[model samples]
Target: MQGWRSSMEDVHCTLLKLDDKAWSQWSYFSIFDGHNGLDTARKCAEDFHRYLLKSFNEMLKHGEPIDGPLKSSQLDLILFRKTIKQTYFFMDEQLRKSKTQHDESGAVVITCLIGPEVIYFMNVGDARAILVSKTGQVLLSTHDHKTSDPDEQHRIAEKGGSIWDNRVEGQLAMTRVLGDFSMDKDLVPPDADIKEYTIHDTNNPLGFIVLACDGIWDVMSNKECAKFIVERMSRTQDLCKICDEVLEECLKRGSADNMTIYIIKFL
Candidate 1:
């Protein structure tokens, strides 16, 4: 949903399943909110997954199957956190080497690697995601990487950057992102923060997960959005209509930026 934005700069990715036998049970979904221009976001949407998958596969050793633990840890998810963080740098390097190397445009990312047993969120900038339990409760949510955040502010200052009007270096609203090659690498780092959650049992499975840009979040609280979707999903089970209603509600509440959302259902 492009809303009132002059041009659509947001892009989304949804892979119901990966192609490899070991990864066949896993899926991927993401939303990239582009800023300044679309080059960075478009490039990310095109080849980002390949970079991520390649990194993941490279990390896998001879004996570790898809669900197996890494060489360093007994837990499978411990390996994924490193993979997700490392992939962010790999992705930023790719953008730096691309034809649009000088493009100042960047994107905030909210991405998920949903596997058979767990879901991992790799996020940057203000884009966010939240998981809801089967009992209609918010389980966990990603933190927005904003310049006003105390830790983000300290990191910026340590790297010779300053915040003005709550914007990083008096420019970017978020402290971390991708494809902002013009910014100082140390200041506006391209790091994807990680969040992990194990899937619940049959008695209380996850109801859904919501991923969206600040357009939706600026106007709606986490609880508000989750409640809105749960109420409709229970009554109609129409994801499309539910999304449309969300957009309309955001628009009504004066969300001027482009709006997009993904509802990953578990039940």
Candidate 2:
């Protein structure tokens, strides 16, 4: 992690072993990028994982049966999506009601839940989650919620909000985020974009997954970051070192913001 601001406003969480037996072995990773202040990001880093685990446990206990003749992998994907969606909404609602002061700060979030059989991701605002396949392919990536996006612009207009110089109400550059009482609640949605992937080829395996805030992305593309990791993977499997190198590279490329990155590799 690197901070350009006087006080760093980005926070992250990595749980390599969320459950050893009950949930069939899973991991969790998240990135929270705060703008204006660190309060929102700090709050999420402290409580988001707990809420996610609670939702995961509930799903394990009373999961719905797979419809029709769907495969087990397909069923797992459906359930994971449902659980993550519930977790996001629940956390957002809780944040909203926790206290009126929370709205003064806001954050972008990207979280990943990796299970033995599948990988699930949830994104809100400009933070991203990217997957690189074993063959060095960009399998999946989350879209940034920028005010310049057509769909986002429409949503903002419908909610009586305006964009100036590609910023929401001439302030926030992102169209979706948590908190931010200064913006219209209807325009700045807390809903996240959730996706799931079934890991069928254990033999070949996936290359890695990268979860990061826009600070890093502003200086590098998904392909660039994945290739950097791939090159390093050929010589070493030290994920921590690789992340440090990436952060250094971003800084060298002139990223002037708080940076946070999380990497997960499949063996």
The TM-score measured for candidate 2 stands at 0.88
Each candidate: RMSD? 2.5, 3.6
What overall lDDT goes with each candidate model?
0.84, 0.81
Q: How many steric clashes between backbone atoms does each model show?
A: 0, 0
Q: Which residues of candidate 1, in runs, are more than 4 Å off?
A: 62-76, 201-204
- lDDT string for model 2 (103-174, tens) is 588899998877667777889999998999876778889988998699999888888889998898898899
Predicted candidate 1: what Cα RMSD to the true structure?
2.5
Worst 10 residues of 2 by lDDT: 66-75
Best by lDDT: 1
Residue 54 in candidate 1, Cα distance off native in Å: 0.8
